[model samples]
Target: MSIQVAVNGYGTIGKRVADAVALQPDMELIGVGKTRPNHEAELAIENGYPLYAAIEDRIDLFDEAGLELAGTVEEMVEAADIVVDACPSGIGADNKSLYEAHDTPALYQGGEDADLVDVSFNARGNFDEATGADHVRVVSCNTTGLSRLLAPLQEEYGVEKARVTLVRRGGDPAQTGRGPINDILPNPVSLPSHHGPDVNTIFPDLAIDTLGLKVPATLMHTHSVNVTLESTPDADAVRELLDEQTRTFLIPEGAGIDGAGALKEFAMDRGRPRADIWENCIWSESVSVEGSDLYLFQAIHQESDVVPENVDAIRAVLGTADAAESIERTNGTMEIGF
Candidate 1:
C-alpha cells in the first residue's frame, strides 16, 4: 500500500520533503499545506501536488496566485495517512494536537521539543531505535552531523567522551532578517549548549558535551569536533572507516575546498544538486588525531542534509516497508543519505 504523505509549511525543508515523497514508489504526495502563496506554493502546484492552505483566511490567495487549492490544512491532515510537520520550530509544537486529532502518525523536524515525539532519530545512529515509534523528530543538522561522526567510533572504538564547538551559519542567507551579520555571536557560552541534551533526546545514555557559536555564514554549519575514544585509532584508519560509511566522505585536500560553497560546487560539478545526502562534507586536510583525541571539521548542509532523514522517518512511522528497502530504491536516483 502506498503511504499517503502530507507536508505542512511549504518552505525549504517542507518543499524538499515533498519532492522526496513524490519520488518514492511506496509513498504518495497527497498535497502540501502552506499559509501564503509564495514561490514554494507555485512550485508545489507546478509539480502537480495538490495545494492546501494552512490559514483559512488566505485560501483565496491560491486562486489569486493562479494555483488550485486542494482544501484546508485540516482536510489534508484528515486525508493523509502520515503528516510531516515541517513547519518552523515553534509552529510544529503548536500543531501536535492536530495530527493526533486525525488519528494519523506524524513526523516532526528537529526544531520541536523532543518531548513531543516517542523517538528522536538520526538515520545512521538511531534508525533501529526509530522502528515502531509513533512520532519522531529528525535531529537538527548539527546533531545529525555529529551523530554520524560518533556512531562509527562508538561502535568500533567505544567513545569515552566528546566535545564539539559549533560554528553555525547565522541562518539561511535568504533568512536575512536574523543575526548580528558582521559580528561573531556566542550562541551559548556555556559548556553544553542544548546540543548535548538535544542529542540525549536520541541517545539518552550518550556521554557528550557541546558548545556553539553563531557566525556570519549562510551556506553551511561547520563543527570542530574532538572525541576521546576508549582506544586510539590512527587518523588515516579513522578516515578509512568514515569513508566506508555511506553517509560520509573525506574531502580531498587538493580539491581547494574551503566552505559550504566549495562542497556544493563540488557536488554540482558532478551534476548533483543535494550533493549526496549524508556526505555532510568532511574536510580531508582538517582530520587530526593525537592519542585518543580525534579531531575533524565537517560541513552540515542546513537546507539539504536532513531531507532524507524526513523520508526515512515517514517510512519508519508507517512501517509499510523497511528502511533498507526504501533506501535501496532511492539510491542513485534520490541520493540516500550519501
Candidate 2:
C-alpha cells in the first residue's frame, strides 16, 4: 500500500513537494492545504490535487474564488499517514499540536526550528536517523547543498572545518515585494551566520562557519565553499569523488554554462518541470585543493534542490526504503541529475 501524504502550505516548497510526492510509486498525495486562494491554489487545482483549506474560516474564501475545498487542514492530517509541513517559518511549530492530536507523522521544512523535529534530515547525510521518527525536518536549500559536498569529503578525507560565503537571492521570482533590489546587504550582520548553525543541526560535530549576503538576483543562490580536510587529496581526485555522488552535477568547462541564467536555460532545454535543477551545480574547474584545503563554487536552485530531499525524507520516515534505495527511486523518477 502507498503511504498517504498531505502537504500543508501550498506555496513555494509545498507545491513542489506535492508534485514530487505524486510522482513516487510508493506515496500517494492525498491533498494539499492552503490558507489562501491565490494563483498557487488555482495551480494545485489545475494539477488535479485536492485542495484543503488550512484555515477553517478561510474555507468560504476559496469557495468564493471559484475553487472547491476538499476539507479542513485538520481533516487532511487525519486521513494521511504523514504530513509534510511546507508552512512558512514558525508556522510549522503552530501546526505541531494538530498533527500530534491525530498521531500523524509530520515532515517539516528547514524553515521550521530543528527542535520541532526528532531528526534534522538530509537524505544523503542522515537518512537512517529519520526512520520511524514522528517528525523529520529536511534542512534548508543552502544546508542541503553544503551537506551534499561535506558528506562525501568527511567520509573520504575527514573535514577539519569548513567556511562558506553564501550569496543569497533576495527572494523567489514570484516574491516581487522582497527587496535588496539594487543593493547587497549583509544579512544578519552577524559573524558566522545562522546557516553554519543550521548545518550543524544535521551533523552536530561538524565545524562550519558561513557568512551570508543578500544580492539583487532572484534566480539562484551561489556558494563559495572552503574546507580544511584532515588529509590532502588531489584536485582531480576531489572532482572524481564529487562526480560519483548521484545528486551532484559537476559543471565542466567548455560547456558554456557560466551562471545561474545559463543553468536555468539548460534545465529548460532539457524539458525539466518549471526548469527545475534538482542537483547541486558545481563548477568543475573551481574544484581546487592546496595542502589540506579544498575549495569550490556551487550554485543551488533555492526552490528546487530541496524538492528531492523532501521525497527521500518521506521514505526515510516511513522506513519503506534505505537511503540508497530512496535516493535512486527519487532521482530516477524525477530525473534529478544530468
Candidate 3:
C-alpha cells in the first residue's frame, strides 16, 4: 500500500516536496495545503494536486481567485497518512495541534524550532531518529549540507571541531522583499551563527561554530568549512571518502564548473527539474588537509537539497524501510545523484 502524503504550504520547499513525494513509488501525494491563492496554488492545481486551504478563514480568498479547493487543511490532514509542513518559520508551530488532533504524523522544515519536533532529521546522519516518531524536523539546508559532510568525516576520521562560514543568498528568487540587494551584510552580526547550534540538534556532542553573511546573489548559498580531525588524511583520501557519499556530488576541477552559475547551468543541461541540484556540490580541488585539519568549499542549493530528505523522512516515520533502503529507493526514484 502506498503511504498517503499531504504537503502544507505551497512555497518553494513545499512545492518541491510535493513533487518529490509524487515520484516515490511507495508513496502518493494526496493533496497540498496553501494559505494563499497565488501562482503556486495555481501551479499545484495544474499539477493535478488537490488543493486545500491551509487557513480555513482564507478559503474565500482562493475562491475569489477562481481556484477550486479540496477542503480545509484539517480535512486533508485527517485523510493523509503523513503531513509535510513546509510552512514558513514560526507558522508550523501554530499548526501542530491540527495534525495532532488527527493523529497524523508530520515532518516540518528547518525554519521551525528544533524543539517543535521529536527529532531533528538528516537522512544520512539520523534517519533512524525519526522512525515511528509522530513529528520530525528536517534540519535547514545549510545544516543538512553540513551534516552530510560531517557525518562521514566523524565516522571515518573522527572530528575534533568544525568551523564554517556560510555565504547565504539574500532570499529565494521569488522573495523580492528581502534585501542586502546591493550590499553584503553580516547577518546576525554576532560571533558564531545559530547554524552551529542548529547542527547540535542532530549531533548533540559535535563541536562546531558557524558565521553567516548575506550576499546580493539569489543563485545559491556557498559554504567554507574547516574540520579538525583526530586523524589526518591526505586530500585524495578525503576526496575519496566524500565521493563515496551518495548525496554528495564532487565537482571536478577539470570540468570547468567554476562557480554556482556553472553548477546551475550544469544541472539545467542535465535536464534536472528546476535546475535543482539535490546533492551537496563540493569542489573537488577544495578538499585539503594539513596535520589533522580538513578544509573544503561547497555550494548548497537551499531550495532543493531538503526535498529528498523530506521524502526519506516520511518513510522513516512510517517505519516502511531502514535508512539505507529508504535512501536508495528515494535516490533511484528521484534520480538524486549527478
lDDT tens per residue, model 3, 87-193:
99999999999899999999999999988989999999999989989989999999999999999999999999999999999988778988887898888799789
- Tell me how far the alpha carbon of residue 287 in candidate 3 is from the true structure, in angstroms, after superposition: 0.7
* Model 1 lDDT per residue over 224-266, tens place: 9899889988888888888877777788878788888887777
Ranking under lDDT, best-scoring first? Answer: 3, 2, 1
Candidate 1 stretches with Cα past 4 Å from truth are 274-278, 336-338
Candidate 3 wrong stretches, greater than 4 Å: none
True lDDT of residue 170, candidate 1: 90
Every candidate's CA RMSD? 1.7, 0.9, 1.0
Q: Clashing residue pairs in candidate 1, if any?
A: 278-337
lDDT of 3 at 335: 94
Relative to the unseen true structure, what is the C-alpha lDDT of residue 274 in candidate 2, on a scale of 0 to 100? Answer: 88
* Shift in Å, residue 219, candidate 1: 0.7
Error of 1 at 113 (Å): 0.6
- The worst-scoring run of ten residues by lDDT in candidate 2 lies at 108-117
TM-scores of the models, in the given order? 0.95, 0.98, 0.98
Clash list (residue pairs), candidate 2:
none
